[model samples]
Target: MYANTPRTTATRHRDRMSYDRDLVHSVLDEAWVCHLSFVVDGEPRVLPTLHVRIGDVLYVHGSTGSRPLRSAQPDGIKVSVAVTLLDGLVLARSQFHHSANYRSVVAHGTATVVTDPAEKSAVLTAIAEKIAVGRAADTRPPTPKELAQTSVLALPLVEVAAKMRTGGVSDDPEDYALPHWAGVLPLRVVAGDPEPDKGVEGVPDYLRAVIGVTG
Candidate 1:
């Protein structure tokens, strides 16, 4: 079955949209950042931030005073979240036919601040691991003061939609005879060389694993 109402129907490109649980979860899991849209005082704002998914919940952390997080508190607040991973560029012979090959996920839902310190801390660990495999254990835990200023908000994995496009250029039949060349340009994210700090003894094993480096 499909997800909630808002995600069930696609006004455009219905064939490219899906509500499959596995597809939605995979998109969210593979994405490192998301654009969250929330309204405050009759105005809408979107902010890009890091997030991590644990089971059916997605957690985003930031300062307690942040506008978006503050608005999403005990009372709960509805927001829109979008995550996209651009895989390639479809270069058609004609400009109008140029398109992008990408996987995107969108969802509308309520988000709320996580009040339980223990749960919040645990969420932080999961988020850290998402950034770098074993990053959570390598750094100092959040202190009381730090935790006080921080806010970890959660959004349920409901009302979600995943849309994706993949293939070569979709050129017009007439364009096939044209001299212009057309093809797909594939792209992907990659890790950069490790930059060790002066005080650090050496690169940690976790860093090595993430960067494909060995000491």
Candidate 2:
């Protein structure tokens, strides 16, 4: 078992906290979006973007003209990223006891621009394939101009923590007999039907497999 990495003065911590690298990676791999928080001009800004995980590294991309991409210069970029997945809603007998059962990972690290064309291409492929498994195989590779206009940043999974809350609501002992209904309202991400582009001729097998639909 991996030991939980301790939270420092700057780290956020509460009851039932975890910081194991494996646990953090597991939560990150399951989610497609991440809130990347960073300091810009002495103010904190959070950017929500799609992300992909490769081993211990987290990759986030944007156009070269994007603010976040421009701000991440060679001097390095310090950032805190959060990925959360809500599993269910806990309904307690008392209104004050309501809470959400979730799995979340918060990571802090410095990001470096991926400049090498070969490596950048590979990372881009990983990003596409992650969004739709096997998509990279059918999609055309980025053109030279496209690659030059895009910016990819790699953030090593350094200091990180994963916190999770599960099970039913915790109500006061006396509230159990209050005659109020209590249970968990589950949440999930269900795949929707895949819609092809207006000019596209046929749906690709990978897209079909991604949405579990037959065209």
lDDT of every predicted structure (CA atoms): 0.80, 0.78
Spell out the clash pairs found in candidate 2: none
Candidate 1 lDDT (Cα, whole model)?
A: 0.80
Q: Evaluated with lDDT, which candidate comes out highest?
A: 1
Clashes of each: 0, 0
Model number with the top TM-score:
1
- What does candidate 1's lDDT look like per residue over 7-101, in tens digits? 45778888998888888888888888888888878998788887778888888764534565775668788878899999999999999999999
Candidate 1 segments whose C-alpha is farther than 4 A from its true place: 1-4, 212-215
lDDT of 2 by residue, 1-215 (tens): 23444541235336657767777888888888888888877988788887788888888764534586666788678888889998899999998989999989887778888777887788889888876788898889998887876687788877777889988889999998998999999987766776678887876767667564211
Q: Compute the lDDT of residue 92 as modeled in candidate 1.
A: 91
| Model 2 residue 2 distance off true place after TM-score fit, in angstroms | 7.3
| Colliding residue pairs in candidate 1 | none
